[model samples]
Target: MKVYNYARIIYYRSPLLVQILAIAFSLIIIFGTLLHFIEPDTFPTLFDGVWWALVSVSTVGYGDYVPTSVVGRIVAMLLILLGTGFITAYFASISGIAATNQQLFLKGETAYKGNEQIIIVGWNERTKGTIDELLTKTPPVKIVLIDASLKENPYASKGVHFIKGDATRDDVIQKANIQAASMVLITADQSKDEVAADMQTVLTILAVKGLKENVYCIAEILTSHQLANAKRAGADQIVETNLLSSFVMINNVLSHGTSPSLLNLLKEVKDSKVCLQEAPTALIGATFLDVTHEMLQNESSLILGIKRGASTYVNPPTSFKIEEHDLLIAIIH
Candidate 1:
């Protein structure tokens, strides 16, 4: 039984084309020797017999050589039938394998070759919007998606590449080329509970950060309680999606139409959208009031406030000094 299992493994592991060619070559050689012995007087050389056997089996029957003996003709007939059958089956098998490989490549089983691309781990409604928004940038960015739930790429554009695998796995992160990625965004799994989803996001964050410490990682968390855990897991940014959703709901309850206004403010219009742009180099030593007026006059932007480190101060005092590395929170549209 062990020997039988071993033989089966070897047989399945070998390529079908190689196996078919080996079998066909053996059959041709065997018949060629038999033909030479049976009709030694008709064929002076064994090479002639082998040549005849190949041509007959291939149905090419060039008629350059033929077996006059009845026994030799019978062998020729059997060789033609068996050879043609195997040849047809071999071609069919090759076509099937080529088709299967193409489908696998399209479904993201193949490794991504793009570099300096965005890596999006997991899938949700927010991810779709993010992808659409990214494609509209001044210079569009390539995005690599890693998700186990998707069977194939949902987007039809070439800007996005998909890999079907667990986001929390190191192999999957490596397949997405995390080391060369410009940014990594991990979305919370909607199918799992809040805690489970946040845990999965944290695990992915840790895996990404472990591989590339400098790669910017933004992770989505379902609950605000998991914010610290995500940050500890090495995420550079943690978006509390559930908390933001609750705030929107609360705002709608307190003031009707407030949610729509907030949504519009956050939505992207054409190529313009609200962003936290870095403070201009010339404005490093200027006061808030000076920079705000310059931005409004020159760039036609509304200066909301400033984001320094992890803290965001909205509508800070006009006298607040604008420092280097400060992010200007403003409305671009």
Candidate 2:
């Protein structure tokens, strides 16, 4: 049979355990002094001192050893008062440490880096849908999600990584690798004010832009009023859910019947149908008309818009010329 290691157990238990032991030892010293004065013959021997100290400190008060003298009894009262308080505090500290360590291990500590990856800031109600869509539509794309409330892995996606921290802080942004990220998406927190959400989004955009001026950033704002504010902060794209909802509602009213084709066109990959494809750079120097005509001839995709440097030209006329570094957003067959 193997004996358990007490030293190892004590080392890992808690820092306060040592202090508790000290308090108990001090009380034993006081009581031993009293016993010596009252009756030197009955005073605890070395082994008795150790045994009695352990039993009494553990609250296992045995009646075998009794204090008869008035001074000895007074010393016992002092031990009762101080020892109980120290033991309670030590247990509380141990509990707190255990809880903190459990939380960190569950959430993980790996930071994000590299390029062609998506960074999501601020988790909210729409986050689940957004994550599901990104995973289903864009396979093998790495994603790093940053939020303060996240204490564990929220989803089981292979490419999703969670970072437990405040998204507004620059350190958190750097941890998420904002500089090398292909796209940064700021989800609006419904619990916060439209202005406050926009402010947070703008601050994140500024941080990413300051680090890497070419990183693409998309911010979701609650209202149209915040659109200009987000744009001014260096966001390449601003999405207003309210505006999109209104457009859908208006279209449904105008045509006595809702067009499934129109709805399908509006539906993003989140709906599990349309997938956004990044057109190859080989199409550079090609005319918009030629590209559209070829797409129609090949029955491959519908060219929707062209992104130049930091600007996006939506529904550009046929004569528009495509330049290098232009990202063409289209629906894949």
Clashes of each: 0, 0
Cα lDDT tens digits, model 1, 1-333, are 999899778867889887886677777888888888989887678887788788877778899777887898898888888876776677788899899877876698877877899999888899998888788776778899899998898873555888999987889999998878999999989899999999899889989999999999999998778888988998887788878989999999999989878978665444565789999999998999999999999998889899999898999999999988999998875
lDDT of each: 0.86, 0.71
Full-model lDDT, candidate 1: 0.86
lDDT value, residue 306 of candidate 2: 83
Q: Model 2: which ten-residue window has the lowest total lDDT?
A: 268-277
TM-score of 2: 0.54
**lDDT at 49 for candidate 1?**
79
Best-performing candidate as measured by TM-score = 1
lDDT of 2: 0.71
**Residue range with the least summed lDDT across 10 consecutive positions in model 1:** 265-274
Q: Which prediction has the highest lDDT against the true structure? A: 1
Clashing pairs in 1: none
